[model samples]
Target: MKWVTYDAGSGPRTGILDGPTVRGLGAGVTLLSLLGDDGERLAEAGAAARTAPTEVRPLDEVRLLAPIPRPPSIRDGLCFLDHLRGCYRAMGRGGELHPAWSQTPAFYFGNPAAVVGPYDDVPIAPGCELFDFELEIGAVIGRGGRDLHPDTAEEHIVGYTFYNDWTARDHQLRDMAQGIGMGKAKDSAITLGPALVTADELEPYRSDGRLHLEVSATVNGREVSRGTLAAMDWTFGELLAYLSRGTDLLPGDVIGSGTVPGGCLLEHVDTPDMAGFSGWLRPGDVVSLQGPALGHTRQTVRPAPPMIPLRTGC
Candidate 1:
């Protein structure tokens, strides 16, 4: 079942996406609450809602929001070796990936408060010159767990959604020199949604223990990058196990698959492939991502507000 959170003038409500229509599951129910809903009650309720005509609306008429607007937490992992390889190439660092990358998936927490709706305008990071978007998949946790095993981690995932891990390349690079955190480089925006598709809905695209869906991205109506989720060297299950080693993963938590290979402009910036185009995202630039089952979304890049001056600069 594909789920959505939308507002139809009144307020935000949980809904089931059925083709051209969005069937609102009524008041008091939120996508966050549904993540922890046990038994067959949700299914039965969704079934019942489909037959009723009370809150159903055309998909184009309602305002869509991220399935779990403000996730409890966001864990983004470097699961795709291609993205790593691309980064290495862009940075002129000639070496194979770290041995630990093959043994365990490493991840960083993102700001949940930075999340925005699919169609929301994404502002360029303040004080950043190289704004970019990362195309990837995000798995939403349905059940909370600790020290989970990789083999059984899939059971805890409720659904998957298209994730845009927006970044500020210059800020990230500068912060790397400090050997510190990402700072505000990735704190600006993270777009999610259109619809959260459950596992069963994406069954047709699953292969080799990973999703083989056709993923493509474009900026300003020009094709920037394209690839499949199967390009990932690590699996979400493995990522879950490593990330949950000592920490608890709660319902409403989102696990990002990092950026897919060739999924972001930073990877193509200095490359011959994107040579003619400016790699950084600019104001009024429209960025889009698409995949089968998982819905598509387009967001226009808006200008960043004036940069806040640092009084105590180093």
Candidate 2:
């Protein structure tokens, strides 16, 4: 079942997607709360939503928010090394993978407060010139655990959703140049929604323990990049294991599989004969992403809001 948080004239409510229709769940039954008790409650809620006949509405009639709009936290992992290779090539740098990459799944914490609905407008980070979008798949944590084993981490994942890791390339490179971090660059916005497809529903595509879904991105209805989920160097289970090594995992915590190969504009910029690419995004550009299992959503780019002046020469 595809679980979602939507508003149909009665405030945000939990709903289950059944084709082009949405069935509202019991009041106060949120997707995050269903992650408790090792998914026992989620199972009950799914069953109840299926049988309840009231509150049924067309999918397009409701406003969709991120399944877990504001998860407790988010950890985005660089599981696709090819994406790094492409970036390095564009930057005139070496394309060799760091040896440590094989030993660990590197990840960075994201701003949960910046999370936005899948279809909401995306504002250009103030002062940002080169904006990009990362096409990724996000796994939602269901059961909390510490130092979980990769083989057993599967028990903790409740569902999957499309993740659009919007980026301000100029801001990121500037921060990384200082050898410090990439927070302010990425904290602008991260899109999640359509619906969180329950893990069981996607089992058929699981191969060698990794989900293999074809993912693609489009700008103003033109396809920009495409790749498969199976291309990741590590599985979601492995990522969970690595992230949980030092702390406890919590329900509603999101795990993002970083940009797929050729999944963002930065990787394509400066390529041979790069026409139709404006080098960066402009206001009114619509960006969208999706996979076969995941529903599609689009957001138009909006000019950044007024910037806060910094204290200078104090």
Indicate which candidate wins on lDDT. 2
Score candidate 1 by TM-score against the native: 0.95
Tell me the tens digit of each residue's lDDT in model 2 across 1-314. Answer: 89999988887889899888999986677888788576788888888889974589898889999999999999999999899989988888868877998888889999999899999999999878888888998999988999999998978988899999999998898889887667678989999988999899999888887788888999988788899889998888899998999899999999999999988888888876358666677899999997888877799999998777686621
**Which sections of candidate 1 miss by over 4 Å?**
37-41, 312-314
Once superposed on the true structure, which residue ranges of model 2 sit more than 4 Å away at CA? 312-314
TM-score versus the correct structure, for each prediction: 0.95, 0.96
As for model 2, its CA RMSD to the true structure in angstroms is 1.6
Q: Give the alpha carbon lDDT tens digit for every residue of 244-270 in model 1.
A: 989899988999998988889878878
- Candidate 1 lDDT trough over 10 residues, lowest sum: 34-43
